[model samples]
Target: MLSMKVLFAHLGREHLGVEYLSAALKRQGHETALALDPGLFGINDNVFHNARLERRFDQTRRVLRALEEQRPDLAAFTVYTSTFPWALRMAREFKRRSPRTPIVFGGLHPTFEPERTLRCRDADFIIRGEGEGALCDLAHALEHGTDPREIPNLGFRADDDSPALNPLRPLIGNLDDLPFPDKGLFERDINFRDDYIVLCSRGCPHRCSYCCENALHRLHGPGWYRRRSAESVLLELEEMKARYRFREVMFNDPILLTHRGWLEELLEGYRRRIRVPFRCFGQPALMTDAMALLLKHSGCQCVEFGMQTVNEDLKRETLGRPETNEQALNAFRICDRHGLPFDIDHMFGLPGECAADHARALDFYKPLRRLNRIKTHQLVYFPGTAITAEAAE
Candidate 1:
């Protein structure tokens, strides 16, 4: 086996995807390092407007210097649309400074916009979908001068040719097969105070028109929702407890209660093993008094409901989320009854959503807001989502 030093560049906040990939690579016996751009941590309400581009540029420069000093055989980058421009800049700088090092880009942006990602002057290759397997394969191929063109699920830029497209790899079937992400990768820098994350499953069951996960399913194929067993998830929790001493585990699952049986098993496992407080994202339809009580007993301290809008017409026709206002209110009431702190996520500026609709949503949540847990944000279109195409139209 060829040995190579790898640097994975993440210009974002604490992301489990990157952490998982980094850990997998290290377990494969390759030298790996991570460089985080500070700007990603500073993102807030005014992120798009007040983002200090120059400061991000400087931070990228510092990271590049560190990469050059380490002289890795390959450099990989993960980027979102917001950070794509800066990540591209860092990749270009790395290529210019170390012409021999190969640069690969991945993440949601690149996965959805492979052609655009490949158009980057400095990007040598782009990995679509998951990065753990693809990145490891690319690293091995690069280190040994193997033909990366043969690798599946990758797009590469070459001289005198358009981007070379490789066949798509099948999505991993047994999620339990993969090892837990290397937590040590970000142990030195990650602040778990306000941000703790866990992924109980991938993909979602609901086809909410505005959601990125729904778009992903449409683009990739249906039945993409795969979940790890309760035992598998509990093992991860045990690892987190042993390693990070985390106070809370936040389930990043797109929807945590899609399967009631799975939710029951997971809650039972948490109650048995973790015995620590946890939180999760929820869809209003799944909320019930019994379910809330079970979750609370199983250490759930908080829940976030995707109560996108209260306008009946807008909720059903525009967003394709058929949840009723009464259902949402009942869910919140369940949370209240169980003493579980709950936050309602409301999105404004959706297509055809007028000021009246926004105000109606506010009014619907106004009584619930007395608990001071309602959070609202202007809708932002993510690529490959139905709303993205709708916005374009």
Candidate 2:
């Protein structure tokens, strides 16, 4: 089979999805490159032009030039709701210059809403589930002139303008079977390599209505959760250390301490071999004093836990989290006792929330302000998620 050149279009953000896919493609004998889009390349809005704007403009030009120069057989994108417009613009521009090339999109936005995404006309294919195996099959079918409609986890438009949404490929049960993500594909484009991200596991225990993670977990059916052996993770880090100099690591898992046994093994491994400073997510309901102490000893610099609202009804009925306010506060007390720096996440503009509710959330945080930092996000109603349905209701 001929080697295909694949180009991934992404915003200037840490998109581990593309990196993982790049690794898969590399293992299957394809060359992959990343084109990081400069954020806020507003095509219509006239904002005050500054040095920052000029620099962003120049970076966008460089990425577009890569499209013309490389002429990749397939151009892919990792689309987020926030970056969908920018991705569409880039895809249309790429297609305009090289109509023969194909455009494939993956990630939460397209995975949940392929119909809406393919409606763009420029998007040629959508990988609806995990991409490693499914995308490899698609590449093979495309190269061999096979029927891609038969491929799992693939969605495309038919000649009659109807959509073909295929079933998802089976989830990779053993995460260790996967190669270490090709960080080089993204690392070369970014300025700094000090802060790196690695996920030792997939799937979250919680069923948060607004969380795409939980929705995705349901997509793969039961037993979607999987974790890597501590040794497997340590080996990947050892390889990463050999290639690049990194100071801090961020575990991208929804909650790092899923199983106490696994967490202990990972922490023990980190203590013995990979002692880089790290931070990870925690859930108030899952917080334990022993886990906090182990994390502190294992060089945990910070922890982030979602406390989306102080409304107990909203937390339990709407968000699908049942941890009580007292329970949430006690989790922080444990962190404070362990002297572990922690932050809390808040959602201000949720479906049934109002300004008073936001203020009430602040009142709830006031007492804990000395113990943890706070960050708030506007409620994002992603398609196919329970929260989106609730919002519509």
Candidate 3:
């Protein structure tokens, strides 16, 4: 098939999803470009803004200007719930400007709410889970003037203009088969210059109630967890080191220490091949003293644990987390003993939380030597999660 350009529009932060999709498209002999909005109102995904103040610094026209310049055959968006409104507005504007070119929406929002997302006339198609193969198929079908209605993991308008969705395909069994994410798309965007980001794995092992991972697990059925081999990851980092000259590596995995054997191999290879300081997420149950020591020896800068609430009862009953409060505290102690700087994720506004719970949390964290941060997040009920259904009742 002849080459066709696919343009991805994203806002608020550097989208790793976009980079991966670009790599997939480019691998298939298709062209790709990015129309990025700096998200000036809120820097680095900390989205906070006043409507009046935000109006003065709207970057829509600038983004649209880039879209017009690129003039891509297909325009795509990687939508999150937080960015859905902005993406919709952008899509509508693009439709007004160029009605013939089709627009496809993919990512978290559209994956869960495909029918609702298709209600918007501008979004011609939506891809549910693991979009690489599905999107490539869609592009090829569109380019070759074939039927895309039968493609797996695709949602689109039917003959009668009602929303139609296809069945999901199996998860990508081997992550190493795909090329490293095409970070070149963000070459002009300055937000993610210092840190080289990578995801060694996809899907979390635990089914936390509030997290979207559970929703994803339901969508893909079984065998959702997948990780790249240590060699595959290190090779990518070596390429990145030569290209970007980054200062630090950020492993953006939900739990990097899930598989001890895989992690040990990766850490050992990382220390030998790439000695850069890196940050990653850990689980309270998994953050043992031995693991902490291994991380410290391998140039780990900071490890973050999701200690959402200190109340073990609330954690087990409400959040579906298996780790106990004692385990969480022990994880902290182990990190402190090993001189490993760590961060704890704390959540407020849990179902049964009161002021006393906050006081208890403070007491729990009163004495810690190597505590790097206590990141706080308010409870949000994402669509189709176990927590969201429970909250509605």
lDDT, candidate 3, 72-166, per-residue tens: 98999999887888899999999889899889999999998899999887799999999999999989998998998899999999989999999
Stronger candidate by lDDT (1 vs 3):
3
| Number of the top-ranking candidate, with TM-score as the measure | 3
lDDT against true structure, model 2: 0.82
Instruction: Give every collision pair in model 3.
Output: none
Q: How high is the CA lDDT of each candidate model?
A: 0.79, 0.82, 0.89
RMSD of each: 2.3, 3.1, 1.5
What lDDT is obtained when candidate 1 is compared to the true structure? 0.79
TM-score of each: 0.93, 0.93, 0.97
How many clashes would you count in candidate 1?
A: 0
- Badly placed stretches (over 4 Å) of model 2 are 40-59, 369-372
In terms of lDDT, model 3 sits at: 0.89
Best by lDDT: 3
Ranking by TM-score: 3, 1, 2
Q: In model 3, what lDDT does residue 87 have?
A: 91
* Clashing residue pair totals per candidate (backbone < 3 A): 0, 0, 0
Give the Å error, residue 223, model 2: 2.5
Tens-digit lDDT track of model 1 for 1-393: 667788878765677888788877887888888786656434532345344754454466668777788888888888788788878888877778899788888888888888878876678888988677888898788777888877888898766657776877888888888888776777667866444578878889888887778877886787578999988989988877876677888899988877889889888888888777887888878888888888888888778888877778878987888888888888887776667888778787876767887777767766663243767777778888886787689
